[model samples]
Target: MRADAVSRAVLEQLRELHCLEPEQTVCCALSGGADSVCLLRCLLELRPVLGITITAVHVNHHLRGAESERDRTFCQQLCAGLGVRLAVYDVNPAARAAQEHCSEELAARECRYAAFAQVQADWIATAHTASDNLETAVHRLVRGASLHGLTAIPPKNGRFLRPLLRVTRRQVEQYLESLGQTYVTDSTNLTDAYTRNRIRHQVIPALEQLNPSVERTVSYTLRSLRREDDFLHQQAQAAYAKCHTGKNTLSGLETLHEALQFRCIAMLLEEAGISCEAPLLERLAALARQGGRWNLSGAVYAVGKSGTLTIETVQLPEPLPEAIPLQMGENRLFSGFVLHARLETVSPAENVANIHKKFANACLDYDKIKGEIFLRPRQSGDRMQLSGRGFTSALKKLIQANLPPERRRTAHVLADADGVIFAEGVGCAARVCPDGETRRLLVLEILGKC
Candidate 1:
């Protein structure tokens, strides 16, 4: 294909991928390199036809001495020549690297994205080409990466868009040459010191010599892998929904294939906002296959017993506090308290059931009691009369029958002017049932710790 045709094809692909609208503002990340320069020039050329406004963002990593400054100046001049606005940010790459405890490349990337996010553009466009994706895939595969890493860089990630991923590096240079555009070349790109440069200059070419079209083949393979990866994610989600009990259990996990099992466990951990390392996952898998127990963050554990897997959170050392008084429609926050409350209306029948549960020390009807509901630490004299038993029982006896000894003192009780109406870790008073003519509803949700 001719250079112009290839350039047009790339531009069309970008236009489709970006879904450019005339009114939308696009921020193009420019480094004055051939790839970025070509990207900026192409977008400028298409602006009138696509009815979009273009803005150039140049992030000076301050790594290449005078060359970095020159690139920013060149980008500013280029944007001026094209009648587009330019935004420039100077970042201390070395300082950031030290602070973030990351390599210079990763620090620079983070700084670049942070700058992009600060810019007032609706979308940020980057000039990552197909060659970069191929390089990334090869690099990650060599490092023993997962399927997600093998997929490499996605074309669209959040507010960032890579419009040139379908294009080649040579095609970008050719397009720039056709427009008589000169771009700065970074000396670091030629050095073998960086892993990416070594792959770009040495590894890719050697592979190409064996198969001449390795880049294209790798790109196609990535596309296929991405589709398969998406399908596996859907299947994993469905499997997770079925075998997952309200409480953690590994019983059904053994039935799944090894790959799905790992995926399901990872998803579960992710949903729980728990970090899952590869070693931990392997340990969990080993425990599932054998009779052993492994402990993880937040005192959670996985144990294999009798060909079944069970994941459970360790019981808290301290007992939960009692339920506190909450105003109508108010949300309550209590430390070590399992029950939460909100006000809602209930019919008379529901009120009677609620009162019965309260008398039986089962549920708390917070609205039925008169006076202010206060939460206080358990006192020695606290007592409540059981409805069916017709006998007043000491709080200690009530707690012994229901909870462990460790929870006796830590438990709080809800009280009013009448007396200890509700035991914090237990039930409410039976005498405070709402009358039949009552119209208001109060809703209290009690959540138990896992």
Candidate 2:
């Protein structure tokens, strides 16, 4: 194909996908390699026609010694020749790898994206081609990954866009050579230390030998799997919406087919801000079938009568006596409690009535509560009057209303210098309401162990 035709095909794919917008700034992540160089060339040629500005961002991972420095210098010259803005970031990938205790590949990816996000650009573009997708699919399949993993790298993920996903590596190299374009190649990519490299260098070639169109077939399979995966996700979402009652029940999940049940559980765990892994899912499934309870990572699972499943996270313990005071809009971990505070102003149009009823913990009218607020464990003989009822109740009775025994013991209560006003994870008091006419707005927060 002609260089112009190749450029047009790539640009058309991006435009159809709505990856680029008119007059919006785009950052191209240039590594001075063949793929990235070709991508940069194509975007530069399309810039004037599309009326968009392009900036080149090079993240020097400082891993390739002199070759890495050369890559940055080449990118700078390329951007200058094209009259595009160039930004460079130098990061110590080794130190980051050690700190994160992650593989060098993952650390480098994180560092590169962190640098890209720091640049002031609407979108970040990368050169991930069809070959990368094929290799990823094969690798994930070998590792026994689910459909989500087999789907591999998406064409568009978050602010990152891959305009070259539909193009093959051979096509990219040919296009560059036809234009007499010279680009660098990272030597690490040739090494078989990484699973992806092993697939690319060995496994894929063997598969292609069996069938010449294996790469294309794999890509098509991934696309179909992506569609199926998306449909399953939708079904799981519908199931979750139907079954979820307040935040604890697994009713709708148990009703689903086994595949849908696993998907629903994984989705719910993610929604609860808990990360799920293969082992956790297996343990959860085992717990569901064994008619017993098990704890995995951040969640607890219990199987009740008639195959009913209950999933709950352990409540965080109370803050320490020496726990630091939280400031507005700050999140801090004290003892076992996650203390988050935010300040907001109440407007005349905004409804501020009965805000205390929403939270089991105290939502003191910021103006009515005097002195600085403190968060600590419940003290003996701590007492407060429940908001709806006229009679006073002890903290012990208030906690028993609808809370598990283990959670109640660790629950923190909010208080002033006088006494406990609001028991965390329980109920608020009537005396804490803001006087409607005089009170403006105060900071209301939930202090809990996450």
Candidate 3:
């Protein structure tokens, strides 16, 4: 390719990044290294044609001591010479690592991205080349990565864009040479101490010997995997919608294909902001296939029973201490639920079975109530008459028979001086239930519990 063609190849990759709006400023993450220097130069050249403004930001991670400071100084000089505005952040990665309880590399990456986030730009550009992506894929694969990890670095991740993702490191060096530009090299990259460095120096070269164009081959494979991953992701989304029983719970996951089943569980975990590896996901699938429970990280637990999986946070709700007065046609808010009561004329089409079938809503015979109704947590000695029993049953017995133990404790009930008029998640008291001769009804609705 020609010199301009080489630069344009990188620029084309940048344009391919998602969410690249026109006429927005591009913040270049310049590290004074070959890949980043080439990225900054290409973005600067393309700025006028693409109708975008350019600014460069550099972070001094303070891990290499004076060498890191030298890199920062070089970035400042380069930006000044090119007339591009620059922002420099001085951060101590060791101190950050100590505070965050993470490795130095992770702390450095976090600090660098934090510095990028501080810049006011529409898109933050990074210099991750195809070579870096190949190395990352190989390293992650060795460490037991899934299909998503095999796809490697994304072109656009949130506000950060890897414009040189399709460009090789050799192309970056060639582009810089054509522009008569020089870049500082990080000595740490030459060391084999880090896994990524080991992969770049040892693993990738060994694979390249098997196939001379290994990087290109990996890049092509990654693109294909990305497309396939996207299709599977969409299928998983559709399957998840079907499996959804409620928030934090899914059903019929066991019936789904293993591919969709794993993705569905992963989606749920991600939605909860919880992290789980392939092993945990596989265990969860097994739980769905059979029946079991697991306590997961982030104070969450998963229970699989009867082909249904429910993931719940560890924080249980605290029931209200006192009874709440319920006024007709008014909404009452309790600790765990909201109650709304309104009087309605019983329609001829509405029957006892229909009213009792709606869990959140219940139609009670209005005339049978002798006092004001109150919404309260189930108290000991509470009793409710089953619709056909002709006698009141202990509320605890009713709840235990119908609801799980956890739900039974937190469940609320509607009551008056007469007795317990209705039990939550159970059914309305038999005495207060609407019958064929009932003219008026108290439509009570209890919502938003567990």
Candidate 4:
């Protein structure tokens, strides 16, 4: 491909995407690779025609040791030759990956974008060509991407623009050759350790054996897919609004078709600050059809019951507050609530079953109440023989059935050394409740919103 053709393609993309404005500033991500080198040079040459200023920003992810510094030096020299301002950022990708608990590739990308964001430009330009998008599509496909992921990278995302997205990787190298420019090669790109490198080196070459122009074909296909995706997203938004109830929950979501319902469920999960993937969203939608419950991330849960789907955050009581010893007959603050425990004697005329009816206060057999009692947040394995109920059940389930989502995080319970004796919202344990022969009673009252 001719250099002029490559440059023209970039200029056309810039204009078509509305990425350039008169007297605007652009920060080009220069990695000293052929693609970035061609992009920076083309933007500089087109600066006069487009009435835009260009600056080169290079991020050195110090994973390749000395080679990383060489890339940075090459970028500095190239920018100097072109009389362009250059900003260099040295980042340790291994350290960042360890800190963020992510892969090295993800850390490098995050660090690169961080450098771009600090450039103070009207637009941040990345050197993603059509071939790069092809690699991205294949990578996401291997990772089980949905239709939206298969659409690949956008030409312009927020303040970031890809001017060379219409051009192929070969065209970029050809453009640099025509300009007699020198570009540095990263040794890691030749290895197949990374998924993208494997795709570029092995998968793409094998794909080209069948369809030589596969990159361009994928580019065309992505354009159509993106348009369809946009339409579906709009429809999903409308459906979500129609089905949405208060407090980040949705009702009657099962009335819509499965496809639209999935999208609406995804939207609701996102609004509830949950990062749900496609498979998880599908599972949640299936559960919605049958009025079931799913445990979501961050101690949140999704319940689809009685034609109403609700997302709730279960608040667990603090461990410190739960460990504190309780003193009888005095009001004490614990986990933002007031608690008062006292010893009471049963009256001769009083009926034990009638006394247990008061749900807020737990009536326990004083003889069974052994050791120092402490209050704490309900834990995962807590089970109790609930008053009136013959069998024991998980405290989490009882809370889900009774209390709202937000209240779960701070729910408190009274427990002796043996186990939980009583829980807020839930009544006293059947085994520990007062009987007809009981005389002294242990009454634990929890005040304020549970």
Candidates' C-alpha lDDT:
0.74, 0.74, 0.84, 0.83
Q: Which stretches of candidate 3 lie over 4 Å from their true place?
A: 297-300, 312-450
lDDT of 3: 0.84
Tell me the TM-score of model 3: 0.68
lDDT of 2: 0.74
Clashes of each: 6, 1, 0, 7
- lDDT: the better of candidates 2 and 3: 3
TM-score, candidate 4, is: 0.70
Writing each residue's lDDT as its tens digit, candidate 2 over 244-355 gives 6656556644567877777766876777666777877766655665567666554454443344456666765444454234456654534455656555455555454554
Per-residue accuracy of model 4 over 1-450 as CA lDDT, tens digit each: 655898898898899886578999998999999999989988988898999989879898888889988999999988898899998887777889999899999988888777777887898899999999999999998888877888899888999999998889888888888888899999989898888898999999999999999988888898889899889989988988889878778888767887788888888888878887888987787777678878987578898876667888888544544356777875554545777788888777877767677533467887887687777778879988876787889988887787789777666677887888877777677777887877788787777743
Q: Which numbered prediction scores highest in TM-score against the true structure?
A: 4
- Model 1, span 196-252: residue lDDT tens: 999999999999899987777787888788889888999988888886765566457
Candidate 2, residue 15: the lDDT equals 84
TM-scores of all predicted structures: 0.65, 0.66, 0.68, 0.70
